[model samples]
Each structure stands twice: as structure tokens, then as C-alpha cells.
Target: MVAAYQKLCPETLDGACRELADRDPALDRIYRERGCPPLWQRRPGFRTLVQIILEQQVSLASGRATMKRVENAIGRVTAQSLAGAGESGLRAAGVTRQKALYCTLLARAAMDGELNLGRIARVRDHEALDMLTAFKGVGRWTAEVYLLMALRRPDVWPAGDLALAKALQAVKKLPVKPGEDVMRTIARPWRPFRAVAARMLWQEYLCRNRAASAASG
Candidate 1:
């Protein structure tokens, strides 16, 4: 079982923001301007995992739209419903063929009792990641995202996330976007609260882009 300390809540998120801001001026600016970033916690289960799969390699808005389509196609996103919908149904619902295969694979695993969400919740962080990634189409990024958003694991960082990379580039004022290795290295100092730091950077990224779009419009 995950320790209480390891699980992030709204209070801990704010505390983490304060701690991080005290150490980094860029993070401080985010807290001062944006306030504490939203907890953005997702429920831990099969449905949330599939949503993360949909998000892979796509814009968040696009991913969300596709998820809504899936919900419209199937009554709900449970393992039974998804399996019944099959790859063709998912593809017709706006999922790419590749992602359709992935969603089907996950549904089969869950239905067969091979992938237990309860077990995943009880396991250690690395073990949880390993179990999630054991299935095809669940890569490190997918698994990390599940831990960070769904499980609310305090330290998990998705170095492969494009938004976080862009935010890092902007916050650090780098000439180019950071590669995964560079991103990991830079994030190391944030330690047990790296996930909160990620939220802060994401806030900066989204707000800045929204402002830019507003200005352009």
C-alpha cells in the first residue's frame, strides 16, 4: 500500500509548491502569478489509464475529444464495455488504429484478471510501474503519467512529456527544448516533490501559450 506521505493531496500540493518556490525563483514566479496549481488528481482505475493512452503523442484537447468519442461510442469505459466495443468500434470513435489495438489489449488484460487495478494500487511505486508497463502499448511515459496523476505518487516525473519539456525550456530560458536525459537531470533537485514542480511548469506553459494565442487573436 502507498504510504500517506507518498500520496499527494491538496494540502501537500500547496506545501510542495511553497517548498519548491522557496528554492527556485522560476517556480516562485509561477506560484505568485498562478497560485498553487490545481491538484489535477485522476481516479485510479482502468478508465483513467485508457485516457492516458489516448493522450499519448497528441494534444491534450485532441486526446480529451477522442476520449469523449469513446464514451459516446460505448456506454462506459469499463473493461467489459471496452472489450465489447473492440478495436473497430474504438477506431470508428476517432482512435488511431495503433491506439485502438492498445485499448483492446488493456481491456483484455483487465478482463482476464491479468491486470488488477487494486493490486497496482497496493504495490510499491516501481512495482506498480513495472506491472503497468508489462502490457503492450504502456510505455514509461504512460506508466509514469498513471502514477503521477492517478495514483498521485509524490515523486513520479514524466520526463517524456512534451509540455513539461517546453515548460522547462521556457523556465530555464534554454535555447532549445530539453531532451529526456537533460530534463531528468534538471528535475533531480526537486526530489520527492518533483511532480508538484511539474505542475508549476505546466501552469507556466499553458498560461503563456494561452496569453500568446489571445494576443495573436
Candidate 2:
């Protein structure tokens, strides 16, 4: 898939820009200002989903720390290891109580053959979402993130993301950050490459925020 992305890079970026520009004129300016970030490649299978679970509601650095502890302690991020780990052990590995329970449930489900990671890759977005969200800790956001980052699905969008909302608001000169419905409407044209647009928006957000901070400083 990474190889395919490398091959299709030009078409992908061009297509994304065309769609975004068609959606709103400001998207052209944002694209010109921000350019593209490194393409996010997925690590195949359950480890990526496990990492996504660890990322929920936490800073990326903190999530990385927690993931590192989990990996070091359990030697694998499989459902079996997560299910087998004692509560004390998981707590020591930096998992929150809620997350620990979720992880345990996920592990048990996987071990019991209830959740099949391999089969997930073959399904469409809605089906994939349904399959994953059936698990204890996996919600719409987490499942969407998994599909976008891990599955490398082109059309996926995280409308619930506050950062995406802010980016859209700033780029489109909206009076306030758009809610999910507005975002969905604004993002419609970007369809298949919405994920790429999302990457561009995030880059724009970081650049603008940094500039603002520097100016204030």
C-alpha cells in the first residue's frame, strides 16, 4: 500500500487539491501555504489499532510513552497479552482504568475469535466501522482513525475532530468553528482524498499557530 501511495503520489495530491479548491476557494490558499506533510503509512494488523486505542484523549507524546511501556511489559500488543496482563501490571504500564478495561475486553474478543483483524482489511468503511465499534473501547473516532491511518482508506474523514473544525473555520473564514454537519458539507467534494486534505489542514494549523505564538511572543 505504501508502494502504491508512492506511485500515485502526484495524482493523489493533484486530485485532492482539485476537490478542495472546488469545495472552497480558501482551500487553494491553505494548500499553497501549507503544502503536504509526509504521507502517514500504516503498520498492518492489530498493533496499529492498539496504538490508536492508546492515543485516545491523550497527547501524542504521552500515548507514545504509554505504548512503549505496554510493548516493553507485554512484548507484544496482541489481544492475548492485553487480556492476560493483570490490572496492576497494566496500571503500571500507564493505562487508565477505563482504557485498561477496554484493552482487556478487546484482547479477549480477539483471542476468542470474535474480532478478526485480517478480515477487517477486506471490508468497506461502514462495515469496518461497525466491526470495530462493536468492541468495548473502539468508538466512531477511534475506528475512523484506524481506517484512515492504519487501513490507508482514501475517503475517510474525522468530522468529529476539533482540530479539523478549527482548520476549516480558519481557512474558510467562517465566523466560528463549524460543527460536524457543516464540516461534512464543506468536506463533501474532497471525498476520496479527504484524508490527505486532513493532513494538509493539520499542517496549516500547526504553522499558523506557531506563527501566532511567535508574533505574540
Candidate 3:
């Protein structure tokens, strides 16, 4: 349950990274050997959330391509533009039918003043997740992603993320990818600093992947 005002900045994230390392020696070794993770913060707003929605179950490159085209088509990603763009136009913008439907629902909600992101930020994490997910297209993973990066909630661990799960598996040397329950149990020790640990693991995941790619090349 993260309070809005208790968001993590770069300085706080640095302290949190150290705190996490101290709690887990293996994670500590990563931190000591590799550099610290970035404070992955996003501005809380409609456009950002919309971008996140476009990113669902897709590669970042794919998501960005779609988002850029959509933004170009609409000139903006506001409720008015989205609602006015219509389904065909959105499809022309490179989004799937499912995503267009999702965009429509989100836009209507936003325009109707149904989704109060700012107020929700002040509430508990579950409450915030609930409020966001109550709308169409937003799920637990999406909601948690918003909480972790957009709202900068300290304790959120989006276990549903494949990247994070894979990273955790590789870092912990698990035989197989852990399920949500297993991920939760493994993440329990990180507690309030789970987001920080997640950031570190994500960085390590990318670093190792890049090295592997380079070696293969």
C-alpha cells in the first residue's frame, strides 16, 4: 500500500538498492559488480497509461511503432482525440482491433471523467489497482506496472511480466520459470523494496542478454 507522496526518486532509489543488496548477498554481488539500476519513473497521466495499454503483450518496438503512428494520426492521445478518431482510423494507425476497442473504452472513461488517476494515487495499492482495472483493457499486470513506474510505488512487483520473471529465474538459477505464487514467495524477502530489486534484476537481465548477443555475433 503505497501512498502517493511516498514515491521514490533517484536518491531514494539508490538507498533502496543498497538496502536490497544488504538483504540478499547474491543481489548484492550484482550491485557491487554492475552499476545500480535506474529509478524508472513515469509521469502519471492519460497518455502514459494509453501508451502502456498499447504495449500489452507486445514487443516494446512493436508498441512504440503503433503508438507513434497513433499519436501521429491523432496529433495527440487525449480523450477527445481518441474518441473522435473512430475504430477504422485507429486501425489505420496500426493498432489491432482488440487494442482499438480498448482505446475506445479508455477514452470514453477518461472523457466522461470516470477514471480519476490522481485521486487513486493517494489510496492503497490494491485500491488503485482495482480502480484502474475496473476499466476495460487494464489488468493486474497493467495496473501494477502503472503503480511501479507511473506512480513510483516502492513495493510493487509485477510478477506477471515475462521479462521480470525470466530475470528472476536466471538470477536465482531456478530450473524453470516461477509461477505467480512462487514469484511472490521468492519476492517476499524483498518486501517494501521489491520494485528496486525488480529494477536491478531487469538491468542484469538486459546486460547479460546483450553480452550473450555480442558473444554470438
Candidate 4:
């Protein structure tokens, strides 16, 4: 289980925002303007893990649609069910061939006890990340997201996320999107509250998108 200090609640989010505002003017502006970001939490398990896998390189809406189809097809998104689905069943659920392979690999690993998520739940962040990433289809981004959204880890930062980079650029008014290294560097100041900072960035991105859509409409 995650430590209470590491988990994000409304109180933690507020606390993080206050600390961020004290340290950085840009983040403070976001806190004052956009209000607090949502407590975006997910249940930590096979379903969420596979959903994150489907989210790779896709829009959030698309990922959610695909995950819905997968859930409909299998009726239960578990190791056994996913293992039984195989590639064809997954393909039938609108999963891409490569993603099917990746999901299957993860399912097989879980089924074979090669990867035990339950056992790793209580481990340190580094160990949890390593355990999650040891399987195929679960990269640094995926692992970090799992830690952030599902585990509610406060300090996790997914620097490789394109949306996050875009959000950062829009907030900072950068001419170009920063690279992953630059994103990581930018997040250094956020430190223990990086996940809260990430939520703020995502919220900014959403607000900007809504405004642009309204203008276009």
C-alpha cells in the first residue's frame, strides 16, 4: 500500500498548490486562475494497467473508447480473461496488433507469476517502477502514470508525455515544445510536489483547449 504522505487527497492537492505558489509565480497564477485540478485517481490493478497501455500514443478519448470495447469483449479485465482473449479477441476489441502483443505479454507475465503487482504494491517507488516496467508494453511513461494516477504518488512526473510538454510550453509561452530532458529539468523545482504540478499543467491544458474550442465554435 502507498504511504499516506505519498497519496494525494484534496488536502494534499491544496497543500501542494500552496507550496508551489510560494515557490513559483507561474504555478501560483495557475492555482489562482484555473482553481485546483481534479483529484485524478484510478484503481490500481490489471484493468487500469491495460487501459494505460491502450492509452499509449493515443488521445485520452480514443484510449477510453478502446478500453471500453476491451471490457465489453472480455466482460472482465483480469489476467485470466486477458490471457484467454489472446490476440484475435483483442483485435476484435479494436486493439492494434502491437498493443495486443503487449497486453498479452503483460497478461502472461501476471498469469505465470513472473510479475506480482500485489507483492510490489508495498515496495518503494523505485522498486514499484522497476517491477511495472520489467514487463513489455510498460515503459517509463506508462509506469510513471500508473504510479501517479493509480498509486496517487505525489512526486511522480511523466516528463516524456507530449501533452505535458505542450501544457508546459503553453504555460511558459515557449516557442517550441521542450524535450523530455528539458521537461525533467523544469520539473526539478516542483520536486516532492511534482505530481500536483502535473495536475495543474493538465488542468491548464484542458482550460486552454476548452477556450480554443469555444472560440472556434
lDDT of 1 by residue, 1-217 (tens): 2233558988888888888888888899889999998888899899999999999999989999999999998978999999999999999999999999999999999999999989998888889899999999999999999999998988888999999999999989999999999999999888878888988988888899999999999
TM-scores for every predicted model: 0.95, 0.87, 0.95, 0.96
The ten-residue window of minimal lDDT in model 3 covers: 1-10
Off by over 4 Å in 4: 1-4
Sequence-dependent TM-score of model 3? 0.95
lDDT score for candidate 3 against the true structure: 0.87
Model 1 spans > 4 angstroms off? 1-4
- Displacement of residue 81 (Cα, Å) in model 1 is 0.9
C-alpha local distance difference test of each model: 0.91, 0.77, 0.87, 0.90
lDDT, candidate 4, 1-217, per-residue tens:
2233557988878888888888888899999999889989999888898999999999999999999999999998998999999999999999999999999999999899987878767787788999888888899999999989988889889998988999999888889999999999999998888899999999999899999999999
The backbone clash count of each candidate, in order, is 0, 0, 0, 0
Clashing pairs for predicted structure model 4, backbone only: none
Please give the lDDT score at residue 210 for candidate 1. 100
* Residue 4, candidate 4: C-alpha displacement in angstroms: 9.0
**Model 3 lDDT tens row, 1-217:** 2232468888778888888888897689779978689887888988888888999999778888899999899998888899999788899988999989988889898888898888888998888988999998998888898899999898898988888888889888999999999989999998888888889988888898999999999
Relative to the true structure, candidate 2 reaches a TM of 0.87
